[model samples]
Target: MSRRILLVTTLLLAGCTSGTPTPTPTPPPVKSGFKLVAFDSCEQLTKDLKAAAKKSVGPWGFSGGMMRTFGAVPDGARSAASAGGTADKAAPAFSGTNVHEVGVDEPDIVKTDGKRIVTITGGSLRVIDAASHKATGQLPLDAWGDADLLLSGDRALVLTHQGGGDVLYDRKMPMRPAGAELILVDLTGAPRVISRYRGEGRLVDARQTGDTARVVLTSQPRITFPDRPAARDDDEDRIKANQRVIDRTSVDAWLPSWTVTTGDTTEQGKVACNDVRRPVTYSGRSMLTVLTFPLSAPKLDSGRPVSIVADGDTVYGTPTSLYVASDQRWRLDFFPGRDNRTVPQETDVFRFDVTGSEPPVYRAAGKVPGFLINQYALSEWDGHLRVATTDSAQQSSAVRVLKPDGETLTQVGEVDGLGKNERIYSVRFIGPRAYVVTFRQTDPLYSLDLSNPAAPRVTGELKITGFSAHLQPVGPDRLVGVGQEATEEGRRQGTQVSLFDVSDPAAPRRLAQHHVKNGYSEAEYDPHAILWWPDTKLFAVPVNEGLLALTVTDNGLTEAGQIAPRASAMQVRRNLVIGGELWTLYENGLQISRLSTLEPVTYLRL
Candidate 1:
């Protein structure tokens, strides 16, 4: 069937099948004098009684009879399976060396052939020997101010900023321009620069397929003008002239380009940036990129880039094509409505074959209604393309699974009763189910059953006590979630590292919890990145303050070490633990140290 027709049919089928009401099984008769009351009715009665008692006699006296009669029911008892049940275990302890003094921001580490490759912000890359836990070599580049890094094979592509107009709302303040560029770093031997592409935003993702690499760039232009109250008729011209100068100055303060290197070199043809202001996502073989407008201004005329993911030969570009083939074929997936409101809507997957073709053919696949494709990831489940999406609009932010053709977008299951405002931030497909980190209103780790992709359900959810920013799957039955707890005074206080047991996707429990110090008011306190080192059973926290590493065990987390950064900025991907050493990226440069010794081998000053 044609893609569009198939999508319509699939949506129809989903509506019909999903709406087919399951016959409510009749409850067995209650024993003796017991009577059943619906949860909603009980809740209402509780509210009313509380209000009445507040205005009547003593609080306990007024509701005593009601509580005695209904509150003791066995069904109302908090079960071990419930969110705050006592059966929930404490987080496990993390054990390992405590390495400190490594300065870096938003660091990502990967191991290859007994060597560790560490990429950090500020445009410096370091290589560490896994066995020795020491830095073997380092490479620095000029384009390293808040750059992103990706590793594919041996080639590293660095995206830097060039120049673009900036905006300011206050006339007294100056306007600044946006600048970005992309630089390719060859990491096979002595690190050297290869190709550089200039732009306004950042180079998000790069995909390597043989000799060609596709690089994606975003440009954001913001111009803010002064708004002065009506002045006296005599002063109108003077005010207008002052406003003009402010407008002109706002457009000139452009920062230098920021760039980093990745291991991708395959050249995939380039495509123009999408004009949409909202986040755009593209699904690749194993990576996904979520592009959002510039942080300073609206994406009306200037495009913005938000998030990017790079892994191996597959790269996904956001806000353009829902799916991009390595050959550059673009598949556009509509939000299933005409208004095109940026808030997520039901997604209709479409197919575009970009291989050896120009102006790729577009085909509709299927639709996933009630489930909005807010954010997604691509994973391999039994060799099939396992696409996972976070549907924030649904009561139970759903995770849908689809076939590689983008056909058959099925609601395999959902995480119900996650509270009204709770949302799933990231979804990771591990084994038979998918592990998701729910944030905001409900802080918990949920395991979803994707075995039956069309009807996936939340089999288990374990409250982790704090808000989570990211989750990393450590094993088939284990996951590490990084989050933060705020103090009673409303300050970002401590880092909460939670480990979950997903042996039963329907009954996950916290295995451990570790709270770290160094909560900074100026820093973005959100635990942005989490990495699990199986070699040492250690978990690392990449925060704005610096890198925090902890050792995990059956008991709980133990402070392994912490590296304080020279200065605090949002650590987009600041610190990483590679080959048993900590690699940190700072505004000054890159810092490399051994995880066990906490000794610095080299500080490649940027």
Candidate 2:
């Protein structure tokens, strides 16, 4: 949900070619503030759930169109389960002009160690040499059944979904959806799987810090609700029957079970129940398990899993904390339809302290009076967390500052009434500053000063013709934005890239803007898909079947040329500069080119 996908080009960065020494980023802090409750017995589980269901005012979107959008045990979940990677002298080298975030690392389809580039695509892992610009080795990722990988040192964690035959949603017949699996690969030479961590539930998302990875697994109880009748003669009987199922269910039945497979030996069972807990409000429809394992460890982590009975479908993370947020859009989209007096739908936010290598420890849970646009809407700074949200009920966008004290995430301050009648298009938090874009007709980029958690105030606002879905910090006061170009009446035209000068927080201005005709970009939503080299002022954005490389300067955006145009949908997935050479990674292969000329020098087919 956050722009939290992780990975990079020979991303092993010990021998960074930046010609400067940078200090190691501080790891996240470890804290266990509040405790969630798991079940010690089946009776308690059934009793608690009955109470929750009895008190719920509206129906939870467990199935139907909302399930198709938010309630699926998805094979494609978008949380970055990246390893907080450090460059080991002996590891491959990888570096980027500007890393994803100061405190969080986002994963990509391809990562490099500077000397070698590693890519996980189409159930295969490919390794390419930076100098040779050719595939050095390749390995299939089928062991994990089509997965995304996170890199740390020379180790890669492959995350995938397995099992669950056909059940997508619908709690009618008891059936489990595809679960999650983690595979460890050693990338010293040929990619080889060394270990596997198996768990129940579809992959929700994962975040890593330094050598540790926090993996999120989400699963739903196999509800035995009877099929809908063509014509119901007794509605009350069916309702009571469902209630009986809830009241008779055990916590074990609600908890997801996972297994560890090391070589040929395997161990499987439900995680310890004491480690699980539910929030104040719940559907009892889903359980979220947050697991942690060292990227460097060759053996499966024996640590007990930290689980929550949350209905979260989205997550965001910083080096210090990982946030799991659930949207009530389903609530708004389902039940009572949207209207003026629909009250306000709030987002439930949970904090997990990942500073420690152990699976995230429960820190706090809070609610904001709106739904988050994505992961970019969440950031952790100093000792507090900041959230950007779009409150449709209030007809406004706002940023809320939250402080985790013991078990509660108390709101310290807020700046609402932003983009009145519109919703948030994107959010980027940099240090004590937050940049928000909201669009309905004209796009307004609002800059807010967050230095004071107790009082956040908007310092500047710039109105433009388009909205930005992603924002990148180019300098201390400069930001590069990518999103859809639109007309004054809010008719979206194509992709747009804009450079904003924010040296004066009180008077932000757009230095330059560029548009891609009849085009759209993934980087607008997936920030990791962008390739930026500050040293050369070249930024690559994948559009359509190729890449749009541009020289972004204080003056304006200068088009270099399109790179690697393919006829298929598996076009350019990633672009990176390793060892000063530009490389584009596609699903089928990779292309290397001259950074200066933008000409293809070689192509390696996977």
Best by lDDT: 2
What 10-residue stretch in candidate 2 is worst by lDDT?
Answer: 8-17
Candidate 1 local distance difference test against the native: 0.38
Q: In model 2, what lDDT does residue 205 have?
A: 66
Please give the lDDT score at residue 200 for candidate 1. Answer: 45
Deviation of model 1 at 175, angstroms = 8.5
Clashes of each: 76, 38
Q: Model 2, which residues run further than 4 Å from truth?
A: 1-42, 50-61, 64-84, 88-100, 143-146, 162-176, 232-238, 330-344
* lDDT agreement of model 2 with the native: 0.67
Candidate 2: RMSD over Cα atoms? 9.0
TM-score of 1: 0.52
By TM-score, the best candidate is 2
Give the per-residue lDDT of model 2 (tens digit) for 1-606: 222232110111111011111212222322312346657765666677566643331222243112211110101111222223554465432343223445355444666656677777667888877776667888976664545666777887877766563223255455555677788888887888787777766676667677787777777665455554526635455556566655665666666787777778887778655666887667666677878888777677543677777666666776777888876542232324422224246888898777767667777888877777666788888998888887766667788888887878877777777877777777888889998888777778888888977778888888889888788776568888888899877789999999999888878899888888878876766666666666777777889778999888875788988885865537787776755578787778778888888887877777
Residue 44 alpha-carbon offset, candidate 1, angstroms:
60
lDDT of 1 by residue, 395-428 (tens): 4444444444332223333333432344444455
